[model samples]
Target: MNETVNQPTYKRQRFLLSFVHQINGSVSVTDLQKLVFLHMMSEDSNYYEFIPCKYGPYSFQLKEDLDILQRGGFVTLDYVQGSERIKATGDFPTGYFFRIPTERGKALMRRAYREYPYYSINSEITDRFFQGEELEQFNRGKQTYAQTEQVLFTIGYEGKSIEAFINTLIQNNVRLLCDVRKNPISRKFGFSKGKLKHIAQTVGIRYVHIPDLGIDSDKRRSLATLDDYKHLFEDYEKTLPSKKRFLDEILMLLQQNTRIALMCFELESNMCHRHVIRDYLVRTNQVRSVDI
Candidate 1:
């Protein structure tokens, strides 16, 4: 027997599948619900309505839509057993995990992401729900995406120990360390290219040295004041267009790695050529910069 489904209901099912697919193929049921709730709160012309529930918000229709998708083979759900610790405490903590969509489901999601790219990114959706303290804490934790378009970060190690520097990278969940120094040598014991690479590798962080992105020692050593830095950056900016190969190499790296830290020696980003590199990336490549 063939059963008929309403257009609205069918659209919602596709939307749900697309949403799950957009968030890296799988998400915990709670996160999926929260993301949907947040999306509805953000967009006035959203598909779902919700009433308040014990866990912040509730949408029975959303659950029904998911079930419909599951029955039609658009999505699959698996029950993850509760942890032993929770069982010992006499409280079970089972989780519902959803798998990636089927081939047919993926086709629909690809179309959905194209139609709704703003809602496709996990960071974009999660950023809306985190508040002051929570936001700070979340930023301090590992970030989820590395190849996030138009996003970059810069860091200075002038006043930091290697341990502190690595900790900062880990805190921010930086996966790649881009050394924008012409000479990867430092007076600091642990900061030389070889040593730094070893340390980064020990902690599962990738290290890359891009000399073309750095200023020559003569220009760097000549800087004595803010005006000098300003002039140097101005001159450095002029050379960026000619360095297309290096710039493309960096863009490729960013595409491959999620979070990258542009490392240099100045304590403040304002005093270093790395900032100029960051600005160049942001201006030329249309990326955003976060100084961490």
Candidate 2:
């Protein structure tokens, strides 16, 4: 270990390090994702949340942390098998971090596929491990997120993980997430505009930032009750009629997309300005609205 390893650590980073060390000092990227996914699925004590990716369940946050450890000299990377040609430029081959699994990693992969069938929905290799009921269950879970209906949804990301928030969109079959914040940003991981957009589209949900529909940040600073929100929204509602052009755009998108979601930052629709927008669409365009 280096002096950098002596520095105080983030809990999640420590968890990742411990996980990698438990299996050995290293693991291939895919198997590590699967292992972490299985651990999270167990006992409901999740240390990280994952989104489905090309191979299966994946966590970008975990990948970033691994890079942090490698840079701190707490870990090393080396290419395995076919990945040898894809070396990192002027560095210790970060490509090595994405290698084929070791024998231990392979065992973990087999275990994860058997235990967490849902996470294996998009698996590149786990398909060979299943047949009969296991295969049917996996196929069923794969289609769980596929819904097609013309329902309008309103959702907020407060007090939820990115995984939870995205899961809502996926579960409701929301095709587009219309962000209704004046400032499309958040301190939360995967909730800021760029990251949120990337995460949404990664899971087949489109994202759009409709900042024109946002309440001013200065206005949202001190709302303490439903009455306060009501008072603010009464005035806020007056401005919507004048912003009809943007509302028209939203209506157009909803019509074209089949299913869309309005998103802001509060957990409850009653506490957020998005409810006002949802109501406006409901009353004027006859858009079906569901607070999620």
Candidate 3:
């Protein structure tokens, strides 16, 4: 006869494998961290203690558990590059991390689900979390902004193809594309102001360049650390109050188009100045912004 595993050990393994399985057997480690954090928050489970880290919530215990699982042959780790082919790019732009489950992992998760159906509650929570609080607020805000109005959307084009970028805008029903760059030129082929505008027109979206709302290239070029970005954005924020004219213009555009997306080059919003602009608009105009 096979030895029975302890309940606590089984539970932890089940939860981890089930979570990975629920996301189609493959998830970025960063995304898995966030999903688990959200799961803990929603279920009030004390499975892990998460602290606010550089990339949202993180848990050392969770990391350790994943390591143990990998060592035991429960899962496999793979590193992938982003779909973009930009040469001489750093890890942030060029590298992608993923966790994939082994056959053993899938079998364990299936057994756990079959034995304890209650664990399936996490699937619902995962779906809702992906919908995002900002998206929820945007849906609510539409009633007040205008019948046809939608929330402001922000996106980064650092590691995406032009097709992917354009599809994202269309999927979100964006009516305007606001280029929040001090200089609207990029070595990335389709992102330069002229090329970007032409593509947006082809898809029936209006494009505008808002250089005044952008951070200077000099300030952005040397951002090797998070502190550097923080300091740069802090200084950027100080200048915003004086740019009332530009802010008002943005508001006017929003009022007319209703669904506008701010475009930048950073993959993550927190690492970019576009988030600063979004927060400022939300703070002053009582409007919601969503990153798409």
Candidate 4:
């Protein structure tokens, strides 16, 4: 119950370092499980949350890690909340919390490094599976979390011109825009598929429209049996075969090129299939999403 009073033991430190190192940067809990699995193979402690920590578990969740990092002045969480369907939903904004080691944290790492010399080990291990940008991604993940303030913006086509939106997307260096609307066409003037695609291409953004990913209106209505959107999401997850297909295609696209944004009608991802897509990506692949 009282974590700080115990201080971090050497066993805890070693396990933590190994867990953090395995993550390599930002990670979701599912990916964290895989990393833990690799580190604690054939060990009963591997499922510590379901079992015991002494044997292995090293179970880490983003919120818990974030809390520890925040206490250490290492990382801060930032998110935007948007109102949709009379409810407020949270979404990730521009970059996530800046992840860096604090001075004290760095001192701890240095001492650990002196003892284990994992950097050299990692250099060799990384050389086997990565190069260039991939290597950078792998290395950047090793830093301890750091907190920083984040700015949140609301989504609206309102007073802004579509050209301006396109320009803003370009400025963000968005590489691929995966349109997840069941129907990519916008009845509203200037938001139609032809115009959006033309504009996106003209600005050097690759656009691929996937319609099957949209929320089924009938299904949503039927599922109105549930009051909470989270429950709706759970039902959607259970019934939607297309969502799984969408994820498979997205993963294939990732293998082709990692940069991509899941686009949908609701500009805020939390209210759309994009949120599900984003969650699946981060949970399964450790990919980051930034709302544009």
Better of 2 and 3 by TM-score: 2
**Which residue pairs show backbone clashes in model 3?**
none
Give me the candidate number with maximum TM-score: 2
Report how far off residue 174 is in candidate 1 (Å): 0.5
Which candidate has the top score in lDDT?
Answer: 2
Q: What is the lDDT of residue 35 in candidate 3?
A: 64
TM-score head-to-head 1 vs 4, winner = 1
lDDT of candidate 1 at residue 266, scale 0 to 100 = 88
In terms of lDDT, model 2 sits at: 0.75
For model 1, how does the per-residue alpha-carbon lDDT over 114-197 read when each residue is reduced to its tens digit? 333322332333344445765555444324423344446799888776756776776566778999899999987469999889
RMSD of each: 19.4, 5.5, 15.3, 19.5
Ranking by lDDT: 2, 3, 1, 4
Estimate the TM-score for candidate 2.
Answer: 0.83
Which regions of candidate 3 are displaced past 4 Å?
1-147
Better of 2 and 3 by lDDT: 2
Tens digits of per-residue lDDT, candidate 3, 1-292, equal 1124221244565567556545553566766666676566556776665532323345555776676656554556667564211111111111222343333323433333333332322222223322467435434433332336558889999977665677677657788999988899988757889878976776568999989998878777788988998998899889998987988888888889989988899989998898998899999999878898
Cα-based lDDT at residue 174, candidate 4: 54
Candidate 4 residues 218-261, lDDT tens each? 65555433255667667666654546776788777655645555
After superposing candidate 2, which stretches have Cα over 4 Å from the reference? 1-8, 82-111, 122-137
Q: Which ten residues in a row have the lowest lDDT in candidate 1?
A: 83-92
lDDT of 2 at 77: 67
- Residue 111 shift from truth in candidate 1, angstroms: 51
